[model samples]
Target: MRHVSGLLVLAATPIGDPRDAAPRLSEELARADVVAAEDTRRLRRLCTDLGVEPSGQIVSYHEHNEAAKTPELVARIAAGDRVVLVTDAGMPSVSDPGYRLVTACIDADLDLTCVPGPSAVLMALAVSGLPVDRFCFEGFPPRKAGERARTFAALATEPRTMVFFEAPHRIAETLTAMAEAFGPERRGAVCRELTKTYEEVKRGGLATLATWAADGVRGEITVVVAGAEPVVADLDTAVAQVLERVAGGERLKDASAAVAQASGLSRKVLYDAAVAARAT
Candidate 1:
């Protein structure tokens, strides 16, 4: 039997500036056998703005109808159709639609590919003036005040630089909670309207940011906060805490990471100690 070929392409759209759209993106958009978009209207406007005319069927696939739509797209792909997926901005499946479709395609052994493009997370981190060597994209924080506070509090001790998306209306309240959870002196930057005419990056301590944004904040926002300062302790003490965390149902790796970050000990050293202790 001749081998069958089916492809699922994920194209990243520009977050703000249409000029940032990649050439490969344009090509894939123009050549796709079918295009699954989070918003069909937005996709058409994007095509018009980019001067590209897509020759494929454009189907709507968003949070609302994702569950029902995914299998349909997968069925078409299984029949040797080229399905292209794109979101309103940035890469799909990064806190967006396309995860279900991707999962479905993966399970069906379909070839999955992507057309790379701009990312607001990377752009904000690049200009945030925070350490970019090690960082985590946290998507969006919780909406409710209590949930949001707990969320920030849980990450209070996270040693990796953190990035989060927030609405303009909630920036002040979010920053205030961050001040309490991560500490008033924790350094951070608020990047707004990235890659647009009103683009701005405000960097300072959390308290300063809270005060500055007390009046109001506007536009799409991406906040980058510095990691927690390493906590110093004896090697033996760190190892003991790691064991305790593991006993409390944490994975050895996760416990080791937490202890290492807290004690300023080498993660490998603590991990090795843990292994040896377990063997003993």
Candidate 2:
């Protein structure tokens, strides 16, 4: 590959097992003028395992500091520096700190490249046993109860398989909420500690998974939900759900809004569907 001048290299580190680290990653780490890592300590350990020491400056770049560090990283790259960005594991900026920096580089008109390696997203999606042809990653959901419910509700009718990252403590609650919003029988998978020694993947209906998670779980968790099955025009069902929400004290417009948002159908579409259902 031609050497990319002034490129922001987004390198992927091994999610686990140092041996999984790619040869190109080590080479880039050694050759780059600046290395922006999500966790500098982890990067140092990875370097030790790879038997390659970074000769250039290594700077901390993570969620808390990404906004502050983006411009500095962009400036270096624009100056024709080869800047490598890495996260604690997997690809940087995928639910990591690299997005801001990558966006900054693009906005600054700097070249960008990648040394792709392990990705939990693809790994889980591949093993998920769900349709992988089309999918979306909805990182972590809101931590608060109401917001999380609303978020999941918004995706209740999403037709594309959905992937999510959830902390161990909240996985059960998230699964429960997902079951309630997407339906208990919706097929899904919960992958924990992927690519690690104790890696485990539990696949089943949302309700079953929620039950298993109720006792508590641990390690990094990635949830893959099968997309919603296409629903035929059932004006009766639509009207019933709408009336139910409204009966629960939601205003007509608010209920319609919730249904529209969740189903990815326009409010006007659902409103018309609801009206037709009530007439029938």
Candidate 3:
């Protein structure tokens, strides 16, 4: 039971090639009552590229001011305004702004919809050559070395293929850390400048990708890592893996949980068995 006077539209912009901009995006841009753009300058450029001029008022809406601006946008939606949200590239809210605004709209019981278009996550996964049937998008890994390593460690045994967005400058270090946590030979793909003229997809083991990226990668980066191979479900084997991780400085509880998740074993059982193994 919701009363909606207006519609909040989340529109997807082209990530690289301008031609990828959907026809409906042009219509949305032209007909919207208010256009919330992550970068107004970029929005203007996009309008020029699409050969369409936005008839609506344009306002800057990005991470820095999304919290303060979300309420206003929601109010506009409640007033029956057709508000369109667009980021610099791809769909908004994936790794960009618009999440706050979306939630605000929902809270206000305003209508919401999206003009589905290009997505870097889906694009990267599709071209990654890794199994995309079951995959998870991890967004951007932490920027700090220690934090990044710990993050990757938690997902070390993740069975679903993982996708991550990373800056060009940190791609080498991130891949190196992934190798350390996920193993040197684990397969992965580095997608760079996707859909652009310099688009490149490098598929190789984590160690190889790390080394290749050390030469310095340039452009937006999307990393797709193969999931961990399934481990034997034997309680003893699972416990041994848990103990091994604990010996390597991981907390016993974390190790137990990680192994249990990756191996389809009971966390309580793994923890108990590992404790008993240690006592002996």
What are the per-model numbers of colliding residue pairs? 0, 0, 0
For 1-280, candidate 3 gives per-residue lDDT tens digits of 5756599999999999999999999999999999999999999999999999999899999999998999889888888899999999999999999888888887778899999998889999999889989999999999999999999999987899999999999999999999999999999999989889999999999999999999999998999999999775988778889999999999999999989987888899889899899999
TM-score of model 3 vs. true structure = 0.87
In TM-score terms, candidate 1 sits at: 0.85
Task: Compute the lDDT of residue 61 as modeled in candidate 3.
Answer: 97
Candidate 2 has an lDDT of 0.89
Clashing pairs in 2: none
Q: Candidates' TM-scores?
A: 0.85, 0.83, 0.87
lDDT of 2 by residue, 23-66 (tens): 99999999989999888999999999999999999999889988
The residue pairs found clashing in candidate 3 are none
**lDDT rank order:** 3, 1, 2
Q: TM-score of the candidate numbered 2?
A: 0.83
Which candidate, 1 or 3, has the higher lDDT? 3
Clashing pairs in 1: none
Pick the TM-score winner: 3
lDDT of 3 at 6: 90
lDDT of each: 0.91, 0.89, 0.93
